[model samples]
Target: MMRIALIGTGNLAIHLVHAFETCNATQLVQWVGRSNTPPKQARDTPYFTQYQNNMDTDVCIVAVADDAIPAVAKELQHIDALVAHSAGAVSIGELEPINRRGVFYPLQSFKKNAPLDWKSTPICIEANHGDDVILLEKLASQLSGSVHQITESQRLQLHTAAVFTNNFCNHLLGIGQSITTKAALPFSLLHPIIRDTFEQSFASQAVALQTGPAKRNDIRTQQKHLSVLSEADAELYRILSKSIFNTHNT
Candidate 1:
């Protein structure tokens, strides 16, 4: 069995703690966290508030915040194990102080206590050495069915796309929710269409599946939406609608 040490108690790290516990091929040897108390998922495992110079494990997976990665990397530089991080945008080079450095970035948003079937999620892996890449692939494959060896530039591009796809989309949806709540309508009313619209994108190119007043160039309906929205939301709506219109006509 592969011995693993996990660092962080954040959203992704919580899910990974569960994943490591459930995976039969790996054992979670230690969990490192900022707090003195370990998360409940760290049950029966050794826990430390700090990274040791040397770890008794095959791999140490750092799932800390992006800005703290280099500092954490410095702490684990002397460890005799593969030191991998679970950040999408952070490059494998951030962990370069260690002999065995790699990335184990899972390309999915994580929420604490939220149920997610890792088997269907994609994990982007990268390493300085061929053998370390293979090791990360092995570890990632155990948690996720899909794993790709992504280059740094490719990872940065993917992260940028993900921001638009997930973060920006959710913020826009939040604006919709606020609008609905103010109008005494349930936000759940948009649930089905929202789910269907996104799911439909998987069938083909998302641009080809575009619909709505913007796509139809229905200026009247676009103006109606804008008039009902607050200044900030209206501005955002106009920008997005104009983007959609440009996408279709161009």
Candidate 2:
């Protein structure tokens, strides 16, 4: 089994560690972190205090923040191993040339306590060499059925699209929940509608599945809903509605 060292213990790292542990082709040996690290109460994995001028493994995965990736790669410069980062926006080459590098990005948002279906999570990868890419693909394929080799630019575009589809969509849900709660309505009432929205989206094109007052240009109800929001939110709602209408009408 290939030995793997995972850096960081955040939400993504937590999910990744579990996936790696379950992969039959790999064995997670070291969990590295920054200096003055907190107590790792979450997992019982072995820990390494530092990454510089020391310990090596078959693969070193830096699943830390985007800004921290470069520093982590620099720290691992002296070590001979396949070094990679789990970042959507950052390029595989962001890590310096001294070490073999690649991207082992899992295209899914992770929560610490929630269980992730490894098979459903898409893994996007890029590598400095053919062998490195093959190695990462082999490892990711064992954990996830969906694995794609994409260019750095394509990965960045994917990340940007995720912000709109996942982040912005969640923000809209939060707003809907707040509006319902303030009006003395249970947010649970919207669950079915929300679930249906996603279900319909998957069954058809998202634009084709779009509905509500904006789709029909029901100006009266649209104005009423906008009136309930603050000036900024009202303007935002108006702009978004118009954009959605235009998109569907095109």
Candidate 3:
């Protein structure tokens, strides 16, 4: 069995704790947080408010903020174990001073109290040594079905793509909700169309599936939409409409 020490108390760390609990081959030896407030879900595991220089674990997983990774890693340098950080955009070099370094990035947005299925989540792993890479792969495989070995550059690109596809799309959905609410319509009314759009996008190229006034270059309909929206919404609509018009017609 591989003993693991997790360092963080954020959403990602919570998800990792829950995921590790289901894997019999892995044991969460310690959970290090900035405060003494123990996570309810990690009641069985030992909790420490500070980093221990000589942790007896196979690997120390730093699941903290991107900016805090370097300091956390420096503190763990004295430990004789593989050290890995869980940041998609942060490079493996941040874990300097430690000869054994790796990355264990989960490519998904996490909510504080949300539950996620570990089997479907994608895990991106990177390491300096081949053996360390294999070890990380083994641990990741136990928690997730989709695991890939990615370089720092590839991981950064994937993270940027995720922001565009997931974050930007969610913001657009929020705008849609606002429009519906203003019109005294239930947000549920848009659920079917939203579901279909996502399903279709997954089955085919999103660009090919594009529709509406912008895609058709219907200037009159685009102008009418802009006229009905608030100033902020109107500006956003104009920008997106122009982008779609240019994308399809030019």
Q: Per-residue lDDT for 243 in model 2?
A: 95
Q: lDDT per residue, candidate 1, 1-250, as tens digits?
A: 9899999999999898889988999999889998998778888878899866555688899999999999998888888899999888887888868899989889999999789989999999998889999999999999988999989899999999999999999998999899999999999999999999999988889988888999999989888888899999898888988899998888
- Residue 90 error for model 1, in Å? 1.2
Best candidate (score: TM-score): 3
Q: Order of candidates by lDDT, top first?
A: 3, 1, 2
When 2 and 3 are scored with TM-score, the better candidate is 3
lDDT of each: 0.90, 0.84, 0.90
Return the lDDT, model 2, position 8: 91
Instruction: Give TM per candidate.
Output: 0.94, 0.91, 0.96
Which pairs clash (backbone N, Cα, C closer than 3 Å) in model 1? Answer: none
Give residue 42's error in model 1 in angstroms.
Answer: 1.6
User: Which window of ten consecutive residues has the lowest lDDT sum in model 3?
Assistant: 50-59
Runs in model 1 with CA error above 4 Å?
A: 53-55
Q: List candidate 2 stretches off by more than 4 Å.
A: 35-44, 52-56
Residue 215 Cα positional deviation in candidate 1, in Å, after optimal superposition: 2.8
